[model samples]
Target: MPLYKTLDPNSQTHVKIWKITETYEDLLQPLSLKPESLERVSGMKSELHQRGFLSVRHLLRAFGYTDLDLYYDEMGKPHLKDGMHISITHSFTFAAVAISDVEVGIDIEKQRDKIAVIAHKFIDYEFDYLNKYADDYIRNLTVIWCVKESLYKLFATPGMLFREHFFVIPFTLEDEETISWIDYKGQKCRFNASFLEFEGFTCAFTLPS
Candidate 1:
């Protein structure tokens, strides 16, 4: 099992990352998936996606749970059968999960120049602090994107615009963590977000304040 890293951010929260070096068949051998899960995996067109899905199940096993202990809502947000708050994310060669007693969300994204092209779609208030010509432009953009995505997952509300409703407070790359807010439908909430970079990918996670 390529369990890349396990983090206990707090006493009540568990974060696990898996580096997917195993083939589809190798990842499939040790687990039994629910009928729906099997069907879902079978329908995935990408082998990398399939491996990411199965690797998550293995991550669950590391947490003393299994495919049987997870389910998704109508919004497609995953939930734990036992009621612990959970969020999952998977990118090209990486998969991650975050579970906490409090509400949480997680995301992993490969750092790429392409995100710079689409940054405007998801960034608003953050632009004031962003310098496109800066050396860390791509890295900063990736963090902002992941931060908004994590907030979106935690909010799970329909029609929430990332540019209009989500805002990430400014912070230098050295900060590693910062505060963000969700303002939508006349309600406001704050969250604490942190990020890390490894092997050219950025992983960001949020916990409600």
Candidate 2:
């Protein structure tokens, strides 16, 4: 498949998503990768992850970038050699990239009942509004997790924990938007977060609010 979706959340931020529907070999055939990137993908134990990794490279091409143009820092945060802020995420069958003049982060997750089992680990303040008995409990949990995951990626701080430092304001699925906070070490920051669900998967991203 080609680029699955493109979004301009703000004038300065651009996002591209790819639906992974090709064989690992099919994905690798077109793109030229940096040696380190080839090494990274070659070390993957699962072909699915290998395909996901390659699909993100295709996404960089959609953004007019090549693998040589992307690199990561000691914190494992991704950067574009041109100085554009960049973030990458891939889960299951979807891979996405978000680039901006300002820092930004994006995440995609497959919705599943098991997310509810680990909800406590990443959820604390959100528990105040969550109702386990609700029919959409799992869906809401997935959205919150996606939002927080994006925040964690954007912040890129060493010791931030989702359960302890991140907070999401109350929101409904229909709105698909929320204000999230990072209260780490007394340095509070906020972001405008948005999310959408498709084919039983949820995708979310955040930019400075």
- Off-target runs (Cα >4 Å) in candidate 2 are none
lDDT of candidate 2 over 1-209, digit per residue (tens)? 57888989888899998999999999999999989999999999999999999999999988899999999889999999999999899999999999999989899999999999999999999999999999999999999999999999998889999999989999999999999999988799999999989889999999998
What is the number of backbone collisions in each predicted candidate, taken in the order shown? 0, 0
Q: What is the lDDT of residue 180 in candidate 2?
A: 97
After superposition on all C-alphas, the RMSD of every candidate to the true structure, in Å, is 0.7, 0.8
lDDT of 1 by residue, 53-124 (tens): 999999999999999999999999999989999999999999999999999999999999999899989998
* Model 1: pairs clashing at backbone N, Cα or C within 3 Å: none
- lDDT of all predictions, in order shown? 0.93, 0.93
- Give the TM-scores of the predictions, in the order they appear: 0.98, 0.98
Q: Candidate 2 local accuracy as lDDT?
A: 0.93
Q: List ranges where model 1 is wrong by over 4 Å.
A: none
